[model samples]
Target chain A: MKSANIQLETLVCPSCTQKIDGALKSLDGIKEDTLKISFATSKVRFDFDEEAVRIEDIEKAINKVGFEVIKSRVK
Target chain B: MQRFIFRNKNKIALINGILIALAFIIRWTAGYMEIFTGLLVAASILGLIPIALQAYQALRVKVVSIDVLVTMAVGGAFAIRNFEESAIVTFLFLFGAYLEQRTLNKTRSAIKALTEMAPETAWKLMDDGEFEEIDIDDVDEGDTLLVKTGAKVPVDGRVLSGEGSINEASITGESIPVAKEAGSGVFAGTLLDNGTLQIVADRVGEDTTFGKIIELVEEAQESKSEAERFIDRFSKYYTPAILLVAILVFLFTRNVELAVTILVLGCPGALVIGVPVSNVAGIGNGASHGVLLKGSEVIRDFSRLDTMIFDKTGTLTQGKPSVAEVQSYGDGIDEARVFLASIERESDHPLALAVLDEIGETDYLEVTDTHVVKGGGITASVGGCRVIVGNQALMTEEGVPLSEQVREDMRRLERSGHSLVLTAVDGELKLLMGIRDPIRPGVADDLESLKKLGVKNLVMLSGDNQGTVDAISSELGLTRAYGHMLPEDKSAYVKDLIGQGEIVAFVGDGVNDSPSLALAHIGIAMGSGTEVAIETSDVVLMNSDFSRLPHALGLVKATSRNMIQNIVIAVGVVLALLASLIFGEWMNMSIGMLVHEGSILVVILNGMRLLRYKLRPSYRLGSRE
Candidate 1:
């Protein structure tokens, strides 16, 4: 399993995190328990199975939800 | 084009606002109803694009956001042909979002400023022995980097050669330049004020101390507190509940305007944003001031601290022992000190180092017939004279007679918490020196400030002997003091205090203090302390400064209070808007959205006040020596 931290542009409202959270949860290979999207820091953290999905796919999912990804790190 | 509209939503908001004003003016002055209606329709459609787009995105994810409520209210008003109401509501929503984004960015500026200060480039030493500039990410551990005057130290490393004074404000929040020479350690992001240095990197990138500080602070600000979790849960059901209420009202009364107004007023914009702004601002302030509050939970616990326990060595007193007093018995005192320095040079005891340090400069002498007395002292012949350096027990063994005056001096030194080191030359008592770890300067004033901040009890626990503990405890005006406590004993005592209904915060440094640091209600570790202590503790005072203690307590108190104030402001504004709508005739969709956005700005400005927080001068610990 690989963990990733994704930074987003500033989130204006707390409810907006729900949109990104729903987007990431719907993707394949992402761990449900490790998905944490913080509206305060405009960052998302989650663990995913590397064999099933790549980080770029996860960023695409977030982008499709109308939020821009500033940067991401996977370890 | 969609992306451009999203990026320039504020510009569109300005155009919509002008259209609304022009329509209002035309309707009142020229009575041109067709042009007024045309302008109103254009303005409403222009403002609705961004909000409806956001609402569509939210709905695609199965989420009910504030944008959804605004979109529904504006669409309902348009369906009912309330052109004035529709135009004003959409304009208010867009303009409100613009103001909110601007002020919310200000609350987050503390972390933004820190990220901007991160060093980006480094001068790397090539294999050819020439220096070349490189990106910071490209530099690796064990690589040698050359740092010039006014350039940031690109990595955490030990100085291999050269010298300079570096400003370490980014790491420790102190702007004063600290001198560095060969073998001195430097951290990333510190600027070399003058001179040059060649350093071999020990830690690079995120492994550097500055990087860890940024990461820790970012995580801290993002972590939720108890109140925040409650608010999050509250809003989860709140928006949907407001929608249900709006639907029921329209079904029961057949009143479209009343239902739309309820939907607009029920947007919990202020309540959703209030607590987080305070949390982020508080943690940011702590990061900038060399104090790390770890998370909102730690801030809550620290502000309620009732008793603070301190380890004697390092936390309260200088850990290094030094000579405190020197008394000589007879003539040839200079010769006696020379013999003392010579004998101490050969011994590895801590007291021996203090003796040699106090003597400063001395001549070396050939020694003969050296004997190490078990737990007594060292006995040797120096420069053809018998020299005995040890405690009084060794004096008794050597039959060195002690006069009544000498005995009185010994008692006085012991009472003052000094360990005695008596030196005798040729069986005559020659010199008596007192050694102890001196209490850190200005600690008394810092303790006073802690008291002023409402810490009910101040206690100290130490492994040192009781006399020294008593002396220090009395001098600093601590309420209680304990001596000869092992690590387990200290943690057990902290447990006992917590069991008895007292909130405890333990301040300590060193490996032995790690257990207590973990067991206390709030563990505050000095930044320069061991890795285990820093990792186990909840709060860290960067630079190991004792003065930041009172400041840390004061800051948390102010932060938690600010959070409550924001919560009240948010909830109160929501209640006022609702009650005014039901009890009075003046409430409408535009007025509701305007007040909702105004309340958010108010809470954000309240949270931002923490960024300028400083311990007042009267409560600040006096200047250090």
Candidate 2:
């Protein structure tokens, strides 16, 4: 498992935050309890299983929810 | 093409807006045109695409969001052949989001400013005595680095040579430049306003104070306050409840238009975003003022605090004491000074430094059999002479005989707020040194300001003698003062205050005060305090300036009041819109959506007020001294 810090381009409203959070949680391999979506900073921090889903897949999932992913760092 | 479309969602919304505007113009000029109806349908469809996609994503995770409600409202309007209402609703929603995105980024600019202040490069001094430019991360501890004029200090270290004026606004939030010379400490992220200096790096990379402040502030902004958590929980039930009500309204009245209007009015957009925005702005304001309120909860608790307890040493008074007078009882006063300075050099007590400071630089004396008595003083043997230096209690324990004149002098000094250290040789009292630590400037005015801010109790606690603590307390006009308190006694006093139903804020700057600091309802650490104190504190005064305390309190009051104002506005708009829909005939789908979007903007603008909050000039009373 690896931790990822992803920055999203300006979450315009709290509803957009809910949409992105929902989309990311439904993706395969994301650790459900580790997900933290900060609407104030437009950043999401989570842990995921690399073997089950790649980092690119997570970004794709966020993009699919109609929000732009600004940058993502893995730790 | 897909990526381009995804990235330019705002531009797509803009184009959809233009289509709606064009459709309205055609209808006004050429009445009842079929092409105008067609254009309206096309604009609504273009706007609904993104909204529908967002709703679909939310549904995949089993969560229904505001986008879902918006999509339903637009689709329901189209089914009813209300092309104008459908086009206007979707366009307004899209445009409102674009405005919100831009404004929310402005609220987050404080953190952006802090991140940008981090120094990226350093001038590392090579072994060959030449400066080489390198990444800050490449610089190691103990490495010598050169900082030129108008450059940022790349690492936290002590100045080795040369001097300069450094603007430490990035670290302490104080705008004024401070003079720096050899042996003076410098921090990373501070700008060297002028001159040049060579420094030895003591702490590098993320270990620097600036790095810690950034990390802490980020974490604090991320943590939710009780009010925020309550709003989140309220929204969890609110959205579903709105859906249930809308469904029941549709089932009973068979009016799809009314049901869709209900859904649009009950979006909870303002209520959900109100609290978090206020918290972010409050934290941002604190960061700019050199006060770090750890989280939203601290602000809530601090604003409500009525009782403040302070530790006397290093907090109410300048912790530095100086020797006021040194009187020798016997011959060889020079020998007495050397013995006292030697033993004091081995001790870390502030009074010991005072004694050494009085007898300037002297030759080292061979000192052996040194022992420190806790809270009393030190005992040592220097050049085969038995020596004891400490307070009256230490002299009494050593069985030293004190003359009548010496006792009179000790009483007068203690009464005048001076701490006396006696040096006894061969079981006879020989030297009496009076040490005085003056009260810090501006303390009196700060106490007055706290009283004005509704602090009912201003108490001082000290381990010093009663006479000294009493004199200092009366000078500061404190409500109460306690002397000769140990660390545990101070903690117990705070606990007693908490038991009495008073919210207490304990302010201190030393390790000994940590227990009391932790026991208080709010722990405030001085910025120049020890590491443990800062870590244990809920709020840190970065420059250790007491004047900021009133400003911090004023901010807390403003933020809490601002949050309440937002809540009332959010809930009020929802109630007014629902009443207009059920009882009046003039309400339409587009007007409802516009009103909802306006309320959201109102609350956001209200929250933004804290970002530019001004501390009243009256609060600066104690700072000048």
How accurately is candidate 1 docked according to DockQ? 0.67
Identify the runs in model 2 with alpha carbons over 4 angstroms from their true place.
B1-3, B25-36, B120-209, B323-349, B355-412, B421-434, B529-531, B618-625
lDDT of 1 at B415: 82
Native contacts recovered, each model: 0.67, 0.83
- Kindly list the per-residue Cα lDDT of model 1 for residues B262-358, writing each as its tens digit: 9999998778788889889988888777788889999999999999999999989988899999999989999998888888998999888888889
lDDT of 2: 0.85
Candidate 1 per-residue lDDT, tens place, A1-75, comes to 998988898889777898898888888899999998877678898899999998988888887767788988886
Give each model's whole-structure lDDT. 0.89, 0.85
Give the interface RMSD of each candidate: 1.3, 1.9
Regions of candidate 1 where Cα sits further than 4 Å from its true position: A1-3, A49-57, B123-134, B138-146, B157-169, B172-186, B193-202, B621-625
